[model samples]
Target: MQAAAPDLWHHYGRTRADTDRGVPDFFPWIWAQDGGPGSEVLGDVTGLVLADLGAGAARHAAHLVVHHAPARVDAIDASAAQHAMAGDLYGHLAPRLRTLHANAAEHLEAHPDEYDVLYSVFGGLDFADPRRLLPAAARALRPGGLLAAATLGHYLGGAPAEPDVQHADIPARTPDGTPATMRRWVLQEHVWTKLLDEAGFTAIGVDRLPPATSGARSADTLLLRARRHK
Candidate 1:
């Protein structure tokens, strides 16, 4: 159920704010890293229920609610620091956006209530163990609920042809502003489909996001969209 080692992720949360500040002048405007472009790949939720797994600071959730208009969004993150930062950054979205500092699987298990949609942007689906995450997603979403997720296109250990786990790195700045690394989970494309099917989801699509024109990042990141139906 662990996505990142506690100390590593907590340190990441602690130092993330400062590192994000270094991104050009504008972020969500000048660049979009997480979900890519917009919520279009998420299909159409309109006024349906949705949850953002590993929602981080909720910029995407804010976009959906303000621009796309989901009935409500549960912004769930395993990091308390990250959750707090979300509140501080998007307090204006209170009530409409609810933040939950809980593990992705535990949160879904406890709630049990079904959601119309469950999605992530470079989020839990990318790092959390699919055995734990996908099944729990089955419990959390209503029949036919859509599940969409995006992650860095390539795996650090090369493309996975089977159900394999590889180490992933998230670059970060030290508390002293020095370079550092964080760990995460990376999986193969086929494994993802199998996991989703085993979890009670019907595979819908899997696409690799193309790199930006500037070539700042590679086209290695991939998107996985699935649906849970009875």
Candidate 2:
């Protein structure tokens, strides 16, 4: 199924900078912490193949270009708008960085076993079907490849069907059309480990990026790092 959110696209495209400013402390902090994703953990990427699933506006892709300087970096997202912005943001790193427009599932299926590092940040895997997508993600990476994903952790049971009240500070629509809101589906740490194990990844690690300070829900993040086992 496609998780197209035209309304969200319109909302984000029109006010990304403002939105980023409004929630500057949280999103930027989290993005920077993951080294914008690949850059933080995937060291020695000079010649490694890297792919960012549902890369969104590719804030992480932009970071990878400057830090890891990988031989090849492919950023795929279903949103044309986000892809376009990523293209511009990564222009300085042209040829080494490329943007593709396609759903994460389709892209992973089309390029099975093609990358050394497969990951996603603040996009894609946020949905409930990560169980179905993780294997495909694992299949898309070469043997011994790494998969680093950052998702919102849902401390309670079952995916929440409603928007989260905890993220009241963010003032824009979710990349999904819901009012600038958080979905209660934030997963717990155990659920993330189980998903990676079932998908055939070893050395799985699941933990939270604690909020920048006490009593702040905005910067909380759940991180999952796993390596494929042949």
Candidate 3:
């Protein structure tokens, strides 16, 4: 058997996790994470079973559990480091907030029709292949369940988003600091809409959220919302 691949996300959000352990008070869907539509986009998750795909440190998931009163929120991240960080930060929320270690697509596939709401904040929807992840998401959500995700409207360096389904080899670093790369999908709005439609989602909507401030790394965010067919 071959050796396991390095965890490319091991270093992500490490610095912030060390200092800020409190659940977030707001949920921003924009690339800046400074401001924009809040959790209202998920539309009253109270008493709903939800999951945050690729939920990093699960700050947003914790916020929903604490403020929005979701019956339960599964914070799923494939990265061991991210999963561990989420557990360490918000495990106290227990019963209501569960930190899960699993790939977004695989997890959704394993639990069909298990959620009332599924969401991602520049998380799984950006890093995973929509052809697979979107269908799994549709299957995982009960009929009429909501799917919300925030993704890039364009590439980080001001490049235009792909008009077709494609993946970019973005730079990353392994746990040992070795240079590596990861696949990220930055498709145009129409492309995403088409994928969602084909994946058995209905009432699909994509909203563009401009960056709060202009900068070299700044890019617009596309807030995607859809409903599983009833």
- RMSD in Å for all candidates: 5.0, 6.1, 0.6
* Range of the 10 consecutive residues with the lowest summed lDDT in candidate 3: 16-25
User: Model 1, poorest ten-residue lDDT window?
Assistant: 22-31
Rank candidates, lDDT, best first. 3, 1, 2
Off by over 4 Å in 2: 1-7, 13-38, 155-185, 214-219
Best by lDDT: 3
Pitting candidate 2 against candidate 3, the one with the higher lDDT is 3
The C-alpha local distance difference test score for the whole of candidate 1 amounts to 0.70
Write down the TM-score of every candidate: 0.78, 0.74, 0.99
> Which residue runs does candidate 1 get wrong by more than 4 Å?
1-7, 10-37, 156-163, 166-183, 214-217
Error of 3 at 161 (Å): 0.4
What are the lDDT figures for the candidates, one per model? 0.70, 0.66, 0.96
lDDT of 3 by residue, 1-230 (tens): 99988999999999998899888889989998999999999998989999999999999999999999889999999999999999999999998999999999999999998999999999999999999999999999999999999999999989999999999999999999999999999999999999999999999999999999999999999999999999
Q: What is residue 160's positional error in candidate 2, in angstroms? A: 9.3
Is candidate 1 or 2 superior in lDDT?
Answer: 1
What 10-residue stretch in candidate 2 is worst by lDDT? 20-29
Quote the RMSD, in angstroms, for model 1.
Answer: 5.0
Residue 138 in candidate 3, Cα distance off native in Å: 0.4
lDDT of 2 by residue, 2-71 (tens): 9745534444444564344221121232422533333456657787888888776666666666666688
Q: After superposition, how far is residue 85 of candidate 2 from its true place, in Å?
A: 1.5
- What is the Cα root-mean-square deviation between model 3 and the actual structure? 0.6
